[model samples]
Target: MKKKIVFYVRNLEFHAISKNLQTIVNSLDKKNFEITIIVGEKKYSDFILDNFSKEIKIKFILNDFLTSFRSKKYKKNFKNKIFLDFIKLFLNLKSIYEIKKNNFDTFIDYQGMYLSDFLKYTSIKNKITVLHENRYIGITNDKKRKKIKKKFKNYNKIIFLAKEQTNDFKLLYPDLKDRFFNIYNCFDINKIKELSMEKFTFDEIKWVDNKNYGLMLSRLENGKDFQTVLNALGELKKIDKLNFNFYFLGEGSLKSFLEKEIKNLNLEDNVFLLGNKTNPYKWIKKSNFVIMTSHSEGLNNVIIESLILEKIVIANKFKYGAEEILQNKYGFLFNNENYLELVNILKKITKENKKSTDYFPEIKKSYSRFSSINILEEFNKIL
Candidate 1:
């Protein structure tokens, strides 16, 4: 008998959770597993629909909270507050009914948010929730943390993205430690390799063929601490001549501020903000190495992508995933607070990393370990 599994998510944005879900559903064993994805948000990018398993089932429900809040008519009406509340009440009841109708053997919360409230109103058991980010951020409310801590008993298994994330959570809630499991975020290693070979349409970045250029594929957000890169570039100029030009590939609210800082540091020519790229693999392939200076992460995908492409990855211990992914074998990690250490390391590697041919085999092995097949197999063990 095929086990019915449903992956539940709040929204289908072009983020890690949606991508991981699509990869899992697209690659699941169709013979052994019957799959469905129920999205709470009404609309998602066609990119999502294109990537999801066409052979399986997918539904996008009108998330009333988001709909009601965004409705212009509701905002114009003086009674909008009460009207929105009524809409929310109707939608919640309807959504709960839809959820109860599905007789799934397992329900996976692809995004770690509050959905247990719906579970309380239904008889469905075997709820599994996966945490995909550094839980330390956006979880500072002591009351909310206590609520989540109390609710941990309701889940069958809580999956963490890294060993360190799991260990930290275990330390906090020793009682629920037995319910926790660790899983690496799956990377479509082969897909990335193929994409990296595609030719680039963007203008060529000016650089010497011999000097190593570092790629930073991340969102320009405060949590990421991108200022460290700028500060490091400024500091490198004072003492030693820096050889690398860094390219940032993602966008965020901090873009303008970062541009200003880069100008102030006189690094405008050295650092280029390429904004967001739907396909960054070609850029990844051309770069000499990759670097991440985030304060925390669940599992940095860029680091894995860099390794798969046979480029050296420089990162900090951050909070989680760094040490586990790098393991002192494939990449380098420096003090998160010490930008100087990052510069020194980058400088040293620029001098030493003349030939990457020797690192390709071992680096490729690291990527194969996190491929989609392994991810589905791990899920099958629990399902």
Candidate 2:
């Protein structure tokens, strides 16, 4: 009999988590396992439904009662806190009932919250929860810590996305180290290649014809540090007498702020915020260089995508995925300093041998979909 593997996701929108889940389900062997997804209702349900394969089973739970109300109207600063508590309660009860009804071989909590409490309450022995990040890092107060500690003890196995992330958890709770597993996020080489084939047109932006350009594909968030890229560009423009452009893809809360900054820097002619594009691979392929300025990340999908597309990447020396991926001469890394450092690095890269595409095949093999499946198999071993 095949083992049943169910992924529980809170939102059904076409976000990164949903996309990653789809890739995992598609890669799993149908003969060995039965894959299913349970998600909340969303306007873009079809975004996920269209990607489903015939071999995989998908279940949608249209539960929006808890999430239906906007937290902004509550007027309390802790509105989100109140709303999430309600969600946690509902999910805990729902998961407990479901586990009792189906008795799945293994219940995997992808979101990794109090859903694990369901297994504890129902006495479902086979259960695993993957923690995406350290919850206590941003949370204060001993009460929240105690609550998380209670939830942490319920999981049969706890999977961490990175080694550093695992170590952080171990440092916090030494006893849970035995249950921690570090599984780096995997990339789908074939799927990335498939996405690359899709054509994207930016004739609306009137991009310069046959000009060297760099691309940054990320949400316009403060943590991403896009201002660094703008400053770098301003320095490059001031010193180097070359005509180059930057194509920024994606949208977020900082869009207006970034727009004002660009105008202030007089970069309206060189930098183009192309907004959010569904397919960013086309821009990646066309660009001469890919840049990432994130203050932190958890195995960024864009870096892997850029590597697969054979575009040279320049990223900040952050504690996260940038240095991890670019260590083997696949790309370049610079310190997080003023624009002078970035300008100097850009000058150096322009002068040095730019034949770094030789490492593409190795990178593709190491982070392939097969690697993810192997990790999942190891995760199942604990159960």
Candidate 3:
């Protein structure tokens, strides 16, 4: 008989968790494992359900009352608060109850937030809670810290995406270090190769025929430091006498601010905001190079995707993934907001004819979907 493994998450969308879950589900052996996903009701869930193979089962859960109540406190807008609360109280509660009813062999909580509370309430014994990081324990107030710590204590296995993230967790609860597992987020290497080979249809903006263009695909959040990319672009123009078009993909709160900065810097002609593209990989393939200027990141999916496309990457030396992925050869890294240095590096890479193929084999060998399944299998063994 196949072992039933259920993954609980907020949504089955195109987010980081969903992407990884999709990869893992596709990679797993159907004969040995029966996989089911429990997620909140969202339009993206329909996309996943439609695309997934018949062997894997997909389930929807509604948002809970506590989640809605919390949304009211956090969300400033009154209408949004009301709407979010309704989804939580009705939809989320129903979903949680349904999951509890279908008692699986293994229950994995992908979202480390309120999902833990639901798991704690449920009588599910073989439960594994995966956390990217213990953000609440270290960053929040004493009350919140206690609550998070209590949640951390309840899980059968606590999985971290990176070793550094695991180290951060160990600092908080030294005793639980033994229970902590480091599972590097991985991609389907075969799928990546397949995607790279497939020709993507570019629709809206026309790609510049001759000039090189840089690509940055990320949420326009404050922590992303897109301003740094804009500043670097200005400096590159002045110092290297280089002219390149830049495509900023994805939407965020900083849209207006970034637009204002682009206008102020007189890069209105050069910089183009393509909004959110359903197929960002198409843009990645068309670009001369890719840039990531985040203040911090957990293993970035975009970086890996760019590498698979054989596009050279330039990134700020963030704590988690950029430096880890680049390893000095695949791309260039800037220490700080030194635009002159970035400009010089851009000049060097632009002139080069050959692509860096050094990291490709290693990344394929180590960071594949099969590797992630092996990591999860090891976790299953421990459980």
Candidate 4:
């Protein structure tokens, strides 16, 4: 009999977790396993339905939570934190019940992003939680760490995206080290390369029409450190006599702040915020280069995608994954904190090897080592 498996994620965003989970789903032998994906939000239901429903079933936890008036009204009321939590629990209980009826043998939380979503999966005997960000494990207090460790002990396995992430978590709760497994995020290299082939007219992105550019597909969030990246661009503009517009293509809370900062730095003409493109790979393929300025990350999917498309990349030296991915080849990594160093690296790339496309051979070799085929044995070893 095939084992019934379910993958759960609270966020409905089409992002790394979604892509990585899809990779895992695609790798599973249908003769041996049945798959289902349960997401908490329904707004992006079609995203999974359209791409993945042929092989796996799709379900939602909080059905219509995005369109529900009570949910929306309560979200705006800051003082109703306790009430909001109570209402969410009421809604999630039904979702938990629905999932329980399916009797899945394995339940995998793609990213332990929402604690409530994690709590809802207790009906499944085999619980596997994947923690994507090592740098975001913010529990420093001994008491809280102990409590969290106790919660983690309930799961059969806790997977980290990288070894550095595993080490970071072990520092918080050493006893859980035995239960931890390191599984680097994997992708379909050929699929991404193929998707990058889809043609988009210049009108698809108007700003790039007349500009030499660097592309950054970052969420406008604090962790992305957009300020430091903009500052470095400002510095480069001041020194180097070259014209390059930096295109930022993702959405988050910091969009207005970043826009104002760009204006303040006199970079309104150079830094363009393009707000979450469905096909960022198209821009990645066309840009002069791609960049990552994350203060920290689990493993950036875009970096790998950029490499698969053979784009010259300038990335920040993040705590865990950048070194492992870049590994002094295929791309350049500068100090994310040091503005001057970032500026200098940009200067060197522009002056020395700006329009080069020779990285595909090395990038393909590295990407192959991290592809789903290579990751399959490691993932199954734990089971």
lDDT of each: 0.76, 0.69, 0.70, 0.75
Residues forming the 10-long window of minimal summed lDDT in candidate 1 = 202-211
Residue 192 error, candidate 1, Å: 1.6
Candidate 1: tens digits of C-alpha lDDT, residues 1-383 = 99888778867766666777777787788898898887766656567677776677877667555654644453455587777677666655666666678878787877874565666776667788888886543587889888887667667798998888898888877888989899888877788899898866635544424546778888777768687777888888667776678888888889899889889988876788878777778888888888888888888888888888888788887887888888877777888878888888777777776545454346656777788877767877777
The TM-scores, one per candidate, come to 0.87, 0.84, 0.85, 0.90
RMSD of each: 3.6, 3.6, 3.8, 2.8
| CA displacement after TM-score superposition, residue 13 of candidate 3 (Å) | 2.8
For model 1, what is the alpha-carbon lDDT of residue 200?
A: 60
TM-score of candidate 2 relative to the true fold: 0.84
| Residue-by-residue lDDT tens digits, candidate 2, 1-383 | 98877777776565566666676677777888887766643334465668777887665453445545522246555866777667667655765676567667777787656475566566556677766544455566789877877887887688777677678778877877887787766657666777877654667335635677778888787678787888888877777753677888888889899889889888888888888666677777777788888776656777778887777788887656676667656677788756567777677666563644543435544345335656566655664
Instruction: Return model 3's CA RMSD, one decimal.
Output: 3.8
Q: Which residue runs does candidate 4 get wrong by more than 4 Å?
A: 45-48, 65-79, 113-123, 135-138, 208-211, 354-361
For model 4, residues 1-383, the per-residue Cα lDDT tens digits are 98898777765566677778878788777888899887766646345446764778877766564336333644456567766676567656755666688898887777673443445555777778888775348768878776777668768788888787788777767877888888888777777777777787767757656567898887787778787788898888787745777888988889989889888888877788888777677788878888888878888888888877778877878867888888887788787678888888788777775444464346656577677888887877754
Top-lDDT structure, candidate number? 1
Please give, for residues 169-213, the per-residue lDDT of candidate 3 as tens digits.
788778778877777765665566665544545555456456578
Backbone clashes in model 3, listed as residue pairs: 61-95, 62-91, 62-92, 63-88, 63-91, 63-92, 64-88
Model 4 score (lDDT)? 0.75
> For residue 37, what is the lDDT in candidate 3?
85
lDDT of 2: 0.69
